[model samples]
Target: MGTFSDPTFRDLMAQRPFLRLWAARLAGTSANQMLMVALGWQMYDLTGSAWDLGLIGLYQFVPALTLTLWAGHVVDRHHRGRIVAACLATQCIAAIVLMAASRGHWASRELLLGMSLVFGSVRAFQMTAQQALTPLLVPMNLLQRAMAFSAAGTQVAIIGGPALGGLVFVFGADKVYGLGAALLAVSCILILLLRYTYVALPREPASLATVLAGVRFIWQHKVVLGAVSLDLFAVLLGGAVALLPMFARDILHVGPEGLGLLRAAPAVGAVIVSVVLSRWPLRQHVGRTLLIAVALFGLCMVVFGLSTSFLMSLLALGVSGGADMVNVVIRQTLVQMETPDTMRGRVGAVNSVFIGASNQLGEFESGATAALLGPVGSVVAGGIGTILVAISWRHLFPALAKRDGLQAR
Candidate 1:
């Protein structure tokens, strides 16, 4: 608690850019979290099957994957604030459309899937822009602290949004979408409050030179590559949150309200851990910290998968989330601190591709695994696979851990 409540740390946001950035991130993340629950609940309400929810993920991933490179390049070339505003605006429109469709009698899963595609695409761009803007907001010494603030805002959003989304759905989908739209709309307004006038990227338009340069830079930088790849595979294999509805409806016999808790449990764990990080920092031994955290994440997944009880599942997920939070802080610090000033946009994009690999694509992997093995078996197998990958990676990429932090490593 000392880390979070420390006056020194809170004073770090004395700068206007950091304050505005924090508010903007908080607003955006809350809306994003609301959409996550709303989407899952909406899809399940329509299809009543895990397979269809998986298809919703399939629709979302296509655009998130397809447009990443172009989005990165555009972010590198344009005004990031404007880019973020446009994406938020697009997402606002998507939410309104979704609400309208939900209110109508003619709603179809096909149309909803199309809407997901659009939102996912815009989100990809928005995320890249937001990440690139962070280093510009705060100095290097505070990057880790900045990440904790970011994580906390996201955790608040994740916890609050789903809890509220669950309640809003009882009223109607319109209310849920209205809440998401309001949050995102407010985010657009708050982002404009940034004090600094960051010049857009120079007009030396790149053809293939910039693209390959960014990719090669990341490839050559083992630290960046390793940190991202760890998240990519761990979440890819061990992510069980995507399938919470199945456990909620079929296994644990809980309603949407209980489902909200299941969904929020992980974020709650993350919030707690993030607060700790914000207070005390990771100390030394960043390399070993990351490995231990990820290994713990794998262990938690295994426990969660085998448990049949609702409470057990929540506990397991909470542990997994806690471990993942440690991993997230370490990796984000690595990325933000290590990335060069000029290459932030493209570098952020590369990171997103890794995140996409971890999340949307991971959902697909989980879905496929569930179909092959049952849900229980799939989660256990995935968790075990993650552990094995961590072990293999440690041996295969010994340099990744031995490497130093940030620029000097």
Candidate 2:
């Protein structure tokens, strides 16, 4: 294990281009997190309806699902940094418009939903471009460390963005939106300033085969298939984020400020784990570690669902975040190491879909189930489901369960 002052850590930090990319990612993610906090809180405030809050997630997922594959093709063909920058620019515009609408007293559930659609569309490209671009910035040997470090940055944003948004909400949702817009603009500028090695590949014509290539590749590679699909099902069932507003207001009796703490709890755990992983770089029993981490995440969710005490709930969520960070670092490193650079964008797009489904669509699922089962029942049931999925994957993908390391053998 390496210390904070380790030579490798310093080498990664000293790479100017990667540093710029990391800065841009940190800022952009922070903006996105703030935007989501405002949107979710505002939507609940407007309707006091779980379904409507869930609808915000559904709206975002729809465009991401529809466009991500096509976006992957574009990512492969175009300059990845510019694509990321363009996505940030679009989100900044959306934030500005949302701020205007809020201040103008014209922001409605419909307007929020519309902007969510725009966010979903832009994220499809942004995620693919960013994932593909990372390998180009640093040495392949450092890729795993780079991912862990990047995750550390993302976790910081996740923790601070919501807390900041919640604090800013005291002023108005408009203030939160305005601040998010500014962060996004700064992220866009940083991306524009980034430089990396780019080799233009021969342009390939658009075809169904090309678009579906990432999907086919995953299916053919069972290890990759197992890794991505494990996340899809586990997170799909275990995700409790959509119901957070209800928890904050109705169950926990914690206002938006408390909601911020709830939102930040997971990232608190995630950042700590990410920093550890960045130093140590898991080198053994990675597959078993992945499964154990997921099962632990499910257990935390169960604890969270049953807890009435705010402190207990936060503890459960924070622990769950740590477990999830472990899962993320392993899965991302595994997928990227196994893939060729040419297909990274497409594969990353597919990976993004699984992520989107687990997050955004999972929100929709949580809302619908909460409507039927109440939030407590829905969450408890989902937690158990997540545990079962992990166990089932262990049996179904034995190769993944027996796997040993991040690097392909």
Clashing pairs in 1: 3-279
Score candidate 1 by TM-score against the native: 0.87
Error of 2 at 236 (Å): 1.8
How much is 389 displaced in model 2, in angstroms? Answer: 2.4
lDDT of 2 by residue, 1-409 (tens): 4377878778888888888999999999988989999999999988899999988877887888899999888898888999999999999999999999999999898999999999988998998999998888988777888999999998888778877888898999999999999999999999999887788877799799999999999999998999999999878899999899988888889998799789889988999899998887888889999999999999998998998899999999999999999999999998988998889999999999889767866787899999999999889999999899899989999989999977755
Looking at model 1, report the run of 10 residues with the lowest lDDT sum. Answer: 400-409
Highest TM-score among the candidates is held by which one?
Answer: 2
Question: For residues 207-281, what per-residue lDDT tens digits would candidate 1 score against the true structure?
Answer: 777755557778888877888888899999998877778888888899998887888888889988887777667
Every candidate's CA RMSD: 3.2, 3.1
Candidate models: Cα lDDT each: 0.80, 0.90
Mind sharing the TM-score for model 2?
Answer: 0.88
